[model samples]
Target: MTSPRINSVSIMHYTRPYIELARLEKPTGSLLIFWPFEAWGLTMAAFRTHLPLKYYIPNLLRYLAAAIIIRSCGCTVNDIVDRNIDGNVSRTKKRPLPSGRISVRSALLFLVVQYLVGIVFFVAFLEGLALRTALWQLIPM
Candidate 1:
């Protein structure tokens, strides 16, 4: 029988491609998406309303989560759409899709799952104007 460590290693190996496809290793994209918009907005709101730490911290985390979801979903879609072009570019040629590490069908399925998670997160954690704005962001993706 395989050891637990071996199983975990195998799982990581399996997920490596998907992780690359989402560009999770390089978090600059997600941070860029978050800080410019969400972080500043949250900071402004907290300052204006004297929002408590309890509420402020959790909402900040939710916004970060949303940023990650949006960035990953956008990357996956971009890679899928630019698979052929990416293969020709020196910098992007080794990406998951272009490198043959992942299939288009698999990427599509992953994209769908990402959207579902985003929707569930927005619905579960946000309400009123926040919820409406979050849902609207998904329209372009």
Candidate 2:
């Protein structure tokens, strides 16, 4: 018999619980986390210097993506940290980690992926000292 072959579709299907663990399915959480951060950053940047529409727009989009990823990481970390406590709570007992649908190790791996994507975007979008500094920010998160 041939060994199982995993493809992008299958991987994506399997990753659903982790995605839920990240709270991506719930728009409220991600929006609440990203919107203010994005608004503050854009307001500050726009206030500090006059950037052409072409430049600020792309950067704004990139920052939004970064914020979403960061928010997801925060949610995953919360779930992992609270897994035990969550198991004890009737409301949270059904969550991915507490429900035994997702392992702590798997959740951690998913968090790493989220971090890597955010780091890649920051490094690729920024320049020089900014690139180095941005990469450093990703390490802790």
Clashes of each: 0, 0
Model 1: residues with Cα > 4 Å off, grouped in runs: 1-6
Error of 2 at 36 (Å): 2.2
- lDDT of every model, 2 decimals: 0.90, 0.79
lDDT of 1 by residue, 53-130 (tens): 999998899899999988888888899999999999999999989999889999999999988998999999889998
Best by lDDT: 1
Off by over 4 Å in 2: 1-13, 127-141
lDDT of 2: 0.79
Output the lDDT of residue 112, model 1.
92
Instruction: List the lowest-lDDT window of 10 residues for candidate 2.
Output: 132-141
Error of 2 at 98 (Å): 0.5
Per-residue C-alpha lDDT of model 2 across residues 1-141, encoded as one tens digit per residue: 999998999998787788789887886866775568675778688868987888877777776776677677778888988999999999899889999988899888888888888777877787899678656655544
TM-score, predicted candidate 1 vs. hidden true structure: 0.91
Collision pairs in model 2: none
User: TM-scores, in order shown?
Assistant: 0.91, 0.74
